[model samples]
Target: MASALIEEAHDLSGGAGDPLVHLPDTATALVFRTRADGRGDLVVVGPRTRAAYFAGKDLAVCVRVRLRPGTARPLLGVPISALVDRTTPLAELWGGAAVRLERRLTRLDGDRRLILEQLETALDARMRGPAVRDGLVGAAAMALSARGRERLSDLAPRMGVSERHLRDLLTEDAGLTPKSFARIARLRDALAHGGRSSGLAQLAAATGYYDQSHMTAEFRSLMGVPPGAFFAGRLPALQRC
Candidate 1:
C-alpha cells in the first residue's frame, strides 16, 4: 500500500469498514468502494481539506489515497476542496462519489469491493514498481522528528542535501516541503498539546516561530484564522478533528 495506517481513533463495528489510508501532513484521504463487477465511486480528499459532516454519516465506505510527493495534481476524480464541510453530493466532488452500488445489490449490497479495487488500481499507478529516491526521501522525513523546532537550513546539511534540494525531495514524497509540513505538524502538535498559551509570543517561540508577527502570518495563511482564534476554539471543525 502507498499509505499506512496512522490511527483509527475508535472501533468501526457498525459502519462500512473501508480501509483507511494514512497520509503525511499534506496528503488528502480519498475514500471509496469497489464491487466484484469492476465498478465503483472514488472520493479524493485534497490537501489541507476537511470532510463534510453529512458525508461520513451516509457513506460508510471510503478509500484514502495519499498523493505521491512533488505531484500537486488533484486526486483522480474528486475536487481538492470538496470535503471542506458541505452538504454537496460526491458527484460534485467527482462523478464517482455519487454512484450508489449498495442500493442496486441484494446479498452484496453492503460489500465495498468495487471501490477497493478502483483504489488498488489507483494506488498501483501512483506507487508503480520501485522508488528511485526512497533512501534520501525517507531519511529526510524521519530526520524531522529529531530536528524539532530547528529551521530547514540548519537541518538540511546534516541530511547531506541543500535546503532547496531537501524541500524538493520532501515535496516529491509528501506533497509539501519539509519546513512547511513541519510547521503545520508543529502547530498541530502544539494544538493537541493543549494549554492556554501566555500569548502569541510564547506560542511562536515554542513552535519555532522567530517572532509573534511571523507566526501570526503563517498561522493565518494556513489556518484561515489568527493564532488566538485557534487557541480559543473558534474553528469548531478543526477542534473536532
Candidate 2:
C-alpha cells in the first residue's frame, strides 16, 4: 500500500461559505478539523464511491492522514467494506479515546505546524497497535495507483492468485472491485494533468482510456462534472485529495 500522511490548514474565518463537494477516490483518511470556536472533531473518511459534500465554513484548520487502500481495515479494526461511501466520526470507532484526542486538540493554542505535529503523534501511537494487513491487497493497490490500465489477467499472475480470488480480496480489503479501483485511479491520473493538457482526446489517450468519450463518461460519473467545468475552476470547494 502507498500510504501518506499530510497536514493542511484552511482559514474560513474571513467569511462563511457553502460546503464543497469532493469526488470519490480510493484512499481512506483520518480527518481532524478545528472550527473557529476552538471545537475540534475527528472523523474517519471512508473509501467513497460517489461525490459527497462538506461545508467549508465549518473548518478553521484541517489535518488528514490518507491511508492506502486495504490498510484502514487493520487500523480501524473492521472490514473496509463496512465503510464504503461513508464518513463516520472517530468517536464511534475509537470511543473515549477519540473524545480525549478532541479535547486535547481543542485545548491546544499553537501554530498550524505544532497542531499538525501533535496530530501526527497521536496517529503514530495508534499505529503501534496490532493490525491485520493484507499484503496482496497492498500490492494490488500499488499497481493500480501507478498504472490504472494494467490488466487484471496479468495482475493476478504476478500476485500468484487466480483472478476470481483477487476480486474477492479487493472487495474485502479495499471496498471496491478491481475494475472500480482502476476507474478511480484513471480519473485521478487525468485530473492531475487536466490543467496542463491541450484537449480532452489527447488527455484521454494519455491516461489510458480507449477514447475521449469514454473518459468523459467516467469523469461525469465520479466527479459530477465534465472535465471542462472541473478544470475551469468551478469546483464547489477546494479538496486536498
**How much lDDT does each candidate structure score?**
0.48, 0.73
lDDT of 2 by residue, 13-118 (tens): 3234655656677877777777556778778888888765555554566666677556676677777788888889989888898899888876775355566667
Tell me, by TM-score, which candidate is best: 2
Could you tally the backbone clashes for each prediction? 18, 1
| Model 2 bad stretches (over 4 Å) | 1-21, 53-55, 132-134, 234-241
Give model 1's TM-score versus the native structure: 0.53
Residue 138, candidate 2: Cα error in Å is 1.8
Question: Per-prediction TM-score, please?
Answer: 0.53, 0.82
Identify the runs in model 1 with alpha carbons over 4 angstroms from their true place. 1-24, 33-39, 49-57, 63-128, 145-150, 195-201, 236-241
Model 1: per-residue lDDT, tens digit, 157-198? 876779998777666444455665676666565554437677
Task: Kindly give the stretch of ten consecutive residues in candidate 1 with the minimal lDDT sum.
Answer: 49-58
